[model samples]
Target: MLIPITREKFEQLIPLIATGPQYAYFWGKLPMVLKRLLISVVALVVIFLLGLAFGEGFYFFRLLFSIIAGLYWFWGPIYWASRRNLEIRRYKYSGFWRGRVLDVFVTDEIVGTEETVSNRGELVIVENRERRLNVEVGDETGFTTIMQGPLRRTHKGIAEGQVVEMLILSNQPDLGRIAKTSDIYIPRLNIWVSDYPYLQRVIFAQVSSQLSEAEERDYPDNRAVINRRRRR
Candidate 1:
């Protein structure tokens, strides 16, 4: 199913900025972010004292400190958050599409633990087994792709032949090629799967119903035409 929505509407329905529920994940980074913030503050104090010592060159040193301080913002926690958000937003996508799941495959793989070790190239803890689900889905255009997400929630119930939806990033209006995808939504199950929280859940829920209804009204008219021509 493909619904025509303006790019402005896309940005509105699926905001580029993070929402409330996602802040919980950011809270996990508080310890690491605060640790870095303290280190940066210390550097500022040191630079200021050094600037005072310079006396004649104090103006030059002050400007140098300001430059470093400004650069630290982009180098710090905000930088990490922005990059993570970008992965969710990804390429320029136009069509909002839905497809049917063709297959479901699950596997266990090593994944990183949430625990953090203090600075100076801290150690990263790894877990032995993390379940991952690879679900292959296809749209009306006959384009298929595997969508992967962690095994959790009601996701275990997701099976073959179920409706699956996502943002379609392709140049061709017909969406002949799918280069990238956003979060996957299963309306019937009311479940979503993605590595990150990208959509505005509340707004998307309101819009999903309308799209699902529109999908119900839509028929495979083009498929019928193709079959008739082949018969002729």
Candidate 2:
């Protein structure tokens, strides 16, 4: 199911700081205002203690502390806003959606990473080979897209017919099409796969509940609904 969303609403769902696992793994599971308040209180208290510790007689120390405090107060919010914008900047519009995995194509590929070697030698960069699971998912909307993530990247027995839920985006909303995806959560497996954090996880879960309730309310056939994406 795909539910249309406004840009403003979408931005409001994004987080200012990383929230540890939940509806979306990369995103946090806290309210935006609450997270901001917590960050502010902590940042202020830590800065205040440091400021006092710098002492009253040292002008140099005072100046340094002031700079540090100002930077602390200023950096995070600004940086987060810019990052969130970058996440959605390419997207002209997006949708809150839930769907199922149609197919899985797993293949091993060469991947490189900087790994420290614990031997008579030192740190060495090595090429890491890993399997990639390409999850092809779709809804009744007649649109299908592949969501790639690092990302539970390995093959973990994810098979066809499992429910895959996430947010989908499009460069154009009037067209009512899906071009990109993020924050994929498999409810049955209780796993979140994504290249980057996207939706506010808490809100996502609430929306999921609402969607489920609506589905139950609208009684349909007892038979299963197979997702088919009309080929363009």
Candidate 3:
């Protein structure tokens, strides 16, 4: 008999799960605030340089540039920072895993499809077997090529009733459409094994270590890898 897992328990495990380097590279790193600030400063400097060169008495132009820069410096950081925070929270609070074939059913049929882009992807929609979640996987150029190659052949050849493992994320228990699939893009590692529990643990530990080092270096603002390290 299979045992049931609780969402609360799954959340508690997030801090322990290790994140892949590629995943970390995209999600972790310098706070967006610093990035926006840097961009704004560079833009203003460019505007000033242009004003100096032309000497067209474009003081108004300089002022307009400063205002635009000011807006970006203030709002852009907030936007990206909020987005990053939301992503982290979603991962922390609403992530889960299961070992099952992520069925990619092609509901719509087409003919003579040389190049096809469909809304079809892996939809992580499971019922009470676990929880209802909808994790959609879109086709990227590289992934599409692989799908049409050896992977497709292997996938087709898998024996009926064979079980494969998949990681799923969902917000609701009854409705599977609300889930997002946990797709880790790590080229150096096998994508199939990316969601393995052991790998997740390693990634989280490495991230924690990186955060610790950043804190030790006293680079709070630039510390992208570590979150809330000073308190730790």
Candidate 4:
């Protein structure tokens, strides 16, 4: 059964969806990066002090070892932290929701398209509907490209007017303002995924189940009220 959802529902779902598996995968790696950076800084300071106190003979070897150890400690954590921050920024604006079937439109021509890269070096392409509707989805931090493989290509072909529910990432309006004239204008909408068949199905099923339980709990039958009304 198709559950009717409001704009409020969409707003509520945004935070949950943003913090889901797709996001956790990125965020979980951040702490490791921070740890690596901390280790690197400490090692560099220690090596410098050791060289100053011990003189030339062992200093070069100690410095080299510290550099190597620092790289080892730093590489993985830095990579993961950067990726997590990027994902957080991307989804900070958008979320997923179930909505009633809206009107669908179609177009033969392709509209606007842009491409960006994730910290993992994965490429993401964003395309917009040609209509000048003031639709905003993501924030200044940017959007994480969620789809992979063939599914991404399928969305690339989305026609002009479609009623499909979109996973959109839009900016927070309160943060909207031009900080500097030459600053790159981060559009309010950062990332959107208009097509993801399996993920959509799973998320909708979970939401539907939760909503059903909530509705049942909130609306119980009242037999006493019915009989009293009949007697009156």
Which candidate has the top score in lDDT? Answer: 1
The TM-score between candidate 4 and the true structure equals 0.25
* 10 residues in a row with least lDDT, candidate 2: 223-232
Considering summed lDDT, which 10 consecutive residues are worst modelled in model 3?
Answer: 141-150
What is the descending TM-score order? 1, 2, 3, 4
**lDDT winner between candidates 1 and 3:** 1
Task: Write candidate 4's Cα lDDT for 7-32 as tens digits.
Answer: 45444443223334433333335454
Name the lDDT of candidate 1: 0.67
Off by over 4 Å in 1: 21-79, 83-93, 112-129, 215-232
Pairs with steric clashes in candidate 3? 17-200, 18-200, 18-201, 18-203, 18-204, 19-203, 19-204, 29-224, 134-179, 135-181
Best-matching candidate per TM-score: 1
Over the stretch 1-232, how does candidate 2's per-residue lDDT look in tens digits? Answer: 6777777766666644444432233222344445555666676577667667866665566566556555543355455645664766567787777777888776676755557786878878777777666788887776787866652533485777677778777887663666767767776665666655676666777666676666656745521342121110
Give the range where candidate 1 is weakest over 10 consecutive residues by summed lDDT: 223-232
Model 2 TM-score on a 0 to 1 scale: 0.57
| Candidate 1 accuracy as TM-score | 0.65
Q: TM-scores for all candidates?
A: 0.65, 0.57, 0.29, 0.25
